[model samples]
Target: MTHTIRNLSTLVELRSNEVEKLQSEVAAKESLRERHQKTLDKLTHLYESSGASGRLPMALALNCGDYKQGVMAMAAHQKVNLSMHEADMAVSQRALTAAYVKREVLGQVLEKHQHAAVTAQRSQERKQHDELATQLWYRGHK
Candidate 1:
């Protein structure tokens, strides 16, 4: 039983490690998403601030329009990419949570096994001590 419990504990530890790995992956994806979002925000701010200017050469204005269109396209692409990363992070988070729960349940089982073994040992010791005391009392009285 002890050997089996030890094996189970090892398995649970492996699962915990897997959960940690998944958590790290999720964090990395989140970081990537944040970076993409920041880039999109910067592009948006630039576009908005550009509109504040009142006058421009007609040729320059047409060029600026083209530049703004390009920036908008890039921002849209980044937004879509960020959303995909967010979805991946969510999936990893769910998997990590499930793994953690399984490991915790196994840990509780391992603890129970140890506790039961100790309780049995103590009960046996108490029985032996009671028997020995009773024998000594009878011998002394006789």
Candidate 2:
């Protein structure tokens, strides 16, 4: 039983580590999304502030249009990527929650086993002491 408890403890430790790794991955994905959003915002701001002001050379107009189109495409792609990351994070969160619950249950079982062992030991000690006291009483009466 002790061996089983030890193994379970080790499993719990491993699961905790896995949860940490998943959390870090989620953080990284969130950071990526933030950066992408900032890039999109800057592109939109720049285009709005400059591209709408006046007519330019044909070449310059075409270049500006291409730039706007490219930024829009990148924004779309980033939106999809962000959703994927959010989905992944949600899945990881669920897995982490499950792992924590399992670990908690195992810890409770281990505590109960320890408590029972202590109770049994105390009972045995009490029985031995009673027997010794009874023997002493009989010897004195004799």
In angstroms, the error of model 2 at 10 is: 4.2
> Looking at model 1, which ten-residue stretch has the lowest summed lDDT?
46-55
* Candidate achieving the largest lDDT: 1
TM-scores for every candidate against the unseen true structure: 0.87, 0.76
Shift of residue 28 alpha carbon in model 2, Å: 4.5
Per residue, candidate 1 scores C-alpha lDDT tens digits across 57-84 of: 8888887887888888888888888888
RMSD of 2: 2.7
Write candidate 2's Cα lDDT for 1-142 as tens digits: 5676678678768777876877787677778768867776776676566565138788888887887777777767777776777787688778768777776777777777777767878999999999999999999999
Could you tell me which residue pairs clash in candidate 1?
A: none
Write down the RMSD of all candidates, one decimal each.
2.1, 2.7
Itemize residue pairs with steric clashes in candidate 2. none
**Residue 137 miss distance in model 2 (angstroms):** 2.1
